[model samples]
Target chain A: MASPAYIAVDWGTSSFRLWLIGEDDSILGERRSGEGMTSAAQTGFAQVLQSHLDALAAPENLPVIVCGMAGARQGWVEAGYIDTPTSLSAILTGAVSVPGQSRDVRILPGLAQRDRQAPDVMRGEETQLLGAIAADAKGEQVVCMPGTHSKWVRVVNGQVTGFSTFMTGELFDVITKHSILSHAVAGAADVPADSTAFESAIKAAFNKPALATNLLFTARAGQLLHGLTAAGARALISGTLIGAEIAGALSSAGQGAAITLVASGRLQTLYEDAFRTLGLTYTTVDADAAVRRGLSAAAKAIWPNNERKS
Target chain B: MASPAYIAVDWGTSSFRLWLIGEDDSILGERRSGEGMTSAAQTGFAQVLQSHLDALAAPENLPVIVCGMAGARQGWVEAGYIDTPTSLSAILTGAVSVPGQSRDVRILPGLAQRDRQAPDVMRGEETQLLGAIAADAKGEQVVCMPGTHSKWVRVVNGQVTGFSTFMTGELFDVITKHSILSHAVAGAADVPADSTAFESAIKAAFNKPALATNLLFTARAGQLLHGLTAAGARALISGTLIGAEIAGALSSAGQGAAITLVASGRLQTLYEDAFRTLGLTYTTVDADAAVRRGLSAAAKAIWPNNERKS
Candidate 1:
């Protein structure tokens, strides 16, 4: 195995993922847990980090680079934010070091669109943006990062002109579990995915995003009127939220801007399907790889020599 | 005081209201409770009705007219629906009699729009529509009934052309109580209303309804970036939802259709503010009176003599 060069952690609101990178840019070790900011806040952020490092048996002096909610105001050490419109690479230079830590630890700052009309902020996605887009990329790009809070960024050349956050994933969750739609989607988890219902919902919401909430009601109405299955109801909710989000995100984008989607696992498949259903074209970047690559970029930028002795 | 003519009941998803109507159409007695459909389903619908009726000391032979969820499939009895493009008065004729009841009880039928693409159903609001709009009313009318499941009905010359059900109020409730935005709105109930924030959100969402979910996130972002208070966050969510709902509801209406708002209490005020913010003119109808009037219409149609010893 190549000797470990540095550590990279993507510490989000409810998730913790740490990666030990090798000198040759290979994965040397890995750790993942639910000890994200919420849990870490309760159980001391430094203690949580050290426990993970101890379990991985990482070197004592191995410098660490972090991104996401760990840098949030409520997070450890408060890494703060970098105001837009800023170069994507500005995140690399805006890393805030953790004070009183034995190891050299740094957390990347998030991006904040201080636009009074549309004020928005993003934490972990900024790192993903840093890694997903090429360093010398030209032309406009509409980058979408899907999650609990889906982010759509307007990138011109390397600059992030602005971005918008859609509460799509969280809304889906709450609506499915907490709203009247919950009864409509009960037992859906055991069934196979409903692509037809999903595609139709995507088209409907994409065509009339204003009718998004009304569209959500159709989950129950469809079941009552057309015998729509539980799986179909679930898909309808998911597709409607995503479709409306895409419509809003692209509303302000330049015509024919290259669409870049950074997502992993289920979200990756869902968004790709949405884009296809909407007849929109887009490129895909693995979110897991993107965040890791982002943390790696930050590590190399902060520790140029990649030397343990430094 | 005149003897009781009939008992009018509006039993909804989570609320139940009963009123004893005199021969003069006056409210002789009234009772309200949380024993709506969900609760009555467990406590026995007939028993719940009897408990409330007994509380009012209504005559044993007094006929009762019911509307709302009491007629749903899982309700007391499946009163079924009156399919649309039908006349509003059809609801009076379509009510189904509850079997084995001592009293002449009739459950009002809901309205169902089986448009294949936009299938929708409303149990209680049909009665409200019957009372809110006159039988001889002419021209196109857009009736806005704001509630948990807000029903926006399109009436053309007394005929129910079609309607849309927006899960606006329910979405607002769930998002506020269950989503991450819940944190942003904590303690909002303790603060005064923020009309400025609400109005701006209304305009923003009304103009760009597609950006609703994105606009919702601003509640949190606004707090972080602009020091927005909990009240502002609550208002933002409310306005965004209502604004989007109005935008969708009116999207298909004929140009300059008279807007009729049927609501009471907080919803009445909020939707009124929303309409004013969007520069839309609408006349308000007391929701309580509309439902009562609707039940009264049903009672009179079913029991024309209103005789206790029929």
Candidate 2:
């Protein structure tokens, strides 16, 4: 078996994923937990990282590399942000070293679009973007990294011109669990996906994005007036949010820019469905693979000598 | 004092307000409580009503006129709905008498816009609309009732055309309390309204309604990037939601329809500010008075004899 070289972590707002990379640039061990920034902030980020490393029985002096909220102002150490229109390769060089650690540790900085009117910031996803698109990629590309806060980046040639963050997933979550629509979506999880309802909602919201909230109300009204099932209501809510998000994202995209969707699991499926339903052409990239590759790129750039086989 | 002729009540989903009307249509007594349909449904609706009535000590034979969620399927009694293209006066005649009640008690029917694409139903707002706009109102009138579920009703002449329900207020609430943005607005309640932040957000959202969810995320990003105050974050959330709502409402309105804003208290102030910031002409009406007048209108239509001097 190959020896573990370094540990890579994607510590987000509410989730933590760690991968042990071998000297041959292959994954040797992996761990995932709910101790993202929110949890780690209270429990201590260094302690959390050490505990995970202990579980994997990592080498005593194994170096660690982290991307995401762990580098946020409130995280382990504020790695700060690299302002756009920046090159994808710039992220590899902007890694900030964590001081006072027994072993060498570094965290990648996030990307910030400081447009006064549409100010936006992102963490962890920058690394994912780095791996998702090639360093010398040509032409206009719209990269979508969908999750709690979905990011839509506009990359012209190799430069990230700008990006917009839509609170689609979090809004859908909070709306379902806390809004009056909660009652309408009860028992939705027990039922299958309502494709018709979902498709129609996507179209409706895409056509009239201004009516997004109005369309959300129809989730309940549809049930009350047209006998729409709980599953249908849930799908309608999900589709409406995703639909409006796409509309807003595309509205600012460079004309004829090819879409590259970077997502995994349920979000990937939903976003793919949404793009198809809206008659928009797009390609998909596995978010997990993208983030891992991004971390690998950073590792190779920072510690070139560590990549040799044992 | 004039003899009590009847009792008028606006029993909503989460609130209960009752007024004792004299023979001359004067308010002899009034009662307000949180025993709305939700509470009343759990604790017997009749018992709740009787307790409030007992407090007011009304005449045994006094007829009662009720509106709002008390007429909902899950409310006190199923008063059903009056389909749209309905006359404002039709609401007064569509009151359903509660069976098994000792005194004559009638619950006004809600309005249902059974448009397959945009199905909507409003139990309480229809009454407010009836009172806010005259029976013989001329031209195109856009009635904006801002609340938990803000209603924007389109009335042509005296007939109801259609209405859109925007989950603006409710979205603002859930997003603030349950989403990641909650931390951004932690101490907002302790500070004064951030009008500049509010107005700019309104303009941004109004100009591009599709970017509403994106704009909402700015509340957090703004706090982090620009050192925006908690009050600024709160105002930004509110303005974005309201801005999107107004844009959607006016999008479907007639070319020259006058906007009538029916709201009370903080909502009234916020909405008025939103309208003014947008440079839109609008008239204001107290929501409390509108509902009361609506109940009174229903009472007169049902019991004409009870409205005259004793």
Candidate 3:
């Protein structure tokens, strides 16, 4: 068995994921929990990290590299931001170290677009971008990272020119759970069951992005008038949000820019289907692998001599 | 005071409002409560209506005129819908009576646009429309009725052409209360205190309706990066929703159609401000008065001889 080289962590607003990386850049062990920044802020960040390390039986001297909300002002420490248009590899130089930790621990900074008219910021996604796109890749690329806040980033010759974040996933959550649409979507499965409804909705919203709110209302109207199934209502909503998001993202993107979608599982499938339905070309990258590779990049940059002793 | 001629009630999904109308069309007494269709459906619709009637202490022979959710299938009686493009007066003949009631009781039907692609339904707003626009009025008219579900209707000459319903108000409610923006808007007043931010957001969304969801995320990003206040966040959300709605609503309406904004109090002011910010001219109508006038129109059509005794 290879010895653990370092720990890579992605600490988000409501989730925490840690991977113990071997000297050969392989994953030795992984830990995940709901103890993200929000929880750790109350439970003590150091204690949360120690408990996870203890569970994995990680060596006491193993160093850790962290990304995401752990670097926010409200997180473990403030790592600030690197404003665009900046090189993707520049993030590796912006890591801020924890002062009192027994083991050497550092958190990567986020990226911020400071345009007063369209100000935007992202924490964990910058790390994902670091690993998803090659630093020297040619041509313009539009990368979409879908989640609670779906980010659409534009990379021109390997540098992030700018990005836009759409509250698609979170809006869907609030609408289906807390709005009147809750009744329309009640008892529906997590994933959409009606592909036909989803595709139609995607086309409808893509064609008339202005009618998004109106389209969302059709979920209930469709149920009441057309007897649209609960699953169909859910799909309508999911498709509408994703459709509008894609339309908005592509509006500012370069014409026919190569699309790279960084996502996994349900989100990945949904986006891939959306792109296909809209007839837009795209390539998919595993989100988990991207973030891990990003954290590993930072680790290697920070400690070059930690290679596996065969 | 003139003797009561008929009882008028707008029993909506979450609210109940009753007015005792005199022979001369004067409101002699009124009763309001939160016992709308949802509560009444569980607590007994007849009992709820009777309690309000008992509180008014009206004549036993006085017939009741109803509108809104009371006519829903899940309400007291299924009043059904008047499909467009029909005359505004068509709603008058579509009222369904509540069976087994001691006194004559009738509930007004809603309006339905059965387009398979953009199907929409409005229960109470139909009444508001009947009063907001004159039956004999000439030219194209676009009426904006803002509420939980904002209805934007188009009237060509005297006939109701078609309409669209935007889930603006409901989306605002859910986004502010249940989404991550909830924290961004916490401690802020119900209405926005940041007019600058509101106007700017309105213009931004009006110009690029496709970017509505992206603009919504700026509420959070603005706070994180620009130190935006709770008021700014709330205003941004409100402006974005309203701006996008107006853009979408106008997209289908005649270019020079006169806009009639039928709303009362808070919603009225907010929408008026939105219209002004977008430089769209509109005339205002008291929503409360409009609904009452609509009920009176139906009552008169049903019973022509029920005038004041000279």
Q: Best DockQ goes to which candidate?
A: 1
Model 3's DockQ? 0.83
Q: Give the CAPRI rating of model 2.
A: high
Share of native interface contacts recovered by each model? 0.88, 0.78, 0.73
The full ranking of all candidates by TM-score, starting with the best, is 1, 3, 2
* Model no. 1, DockQ: 0.91
The TM-score of predicted model 2 comes to 0.97
lDDT of 3 by residue, B1-310 (tens): 8889999999999999999999989999999999999999999988998998998898888988999999998999999999989899999999998899998899999999888898899998999899889999898999999999999999989898999999999999999999889999999998898999998999999899999999998998899889889999999999999999999999999757789999999999889999999889999999999999999999999878777432
Which scores higher on lDDT, 1 or 2? 1
| Residue A211 accuracy (lDDT) in model 2 | 97
Better of 1 and 2 by TM-score: 1
Candidate 1's displacement at residue B135, Å, is 0.5
Which 10-residue window of candidate 2 chain B scores lowest in summed lDDT? B301-310
**What level of docking quality does candidate 3 show?**
high
Higher-ranked by DockQ: 1 or 3: 1
How do the candidates score on chain B by TM-score?
A: 0.97, 0.97, 0.98
| CAPRI quality level assigned to candidate 1 from its DockQ score | high
Residue lDDT tens for model 3, A1-310: 7889999999999999999999988899999999999999999999999999999999988889999999999999999999999999999999999999999999999999988889899999999999999988998999999999999999989999999999999999999998989999999999998999999999999889999999999999998889999999999999999999999999999759899999999999999999999999999999999999999999999888877432
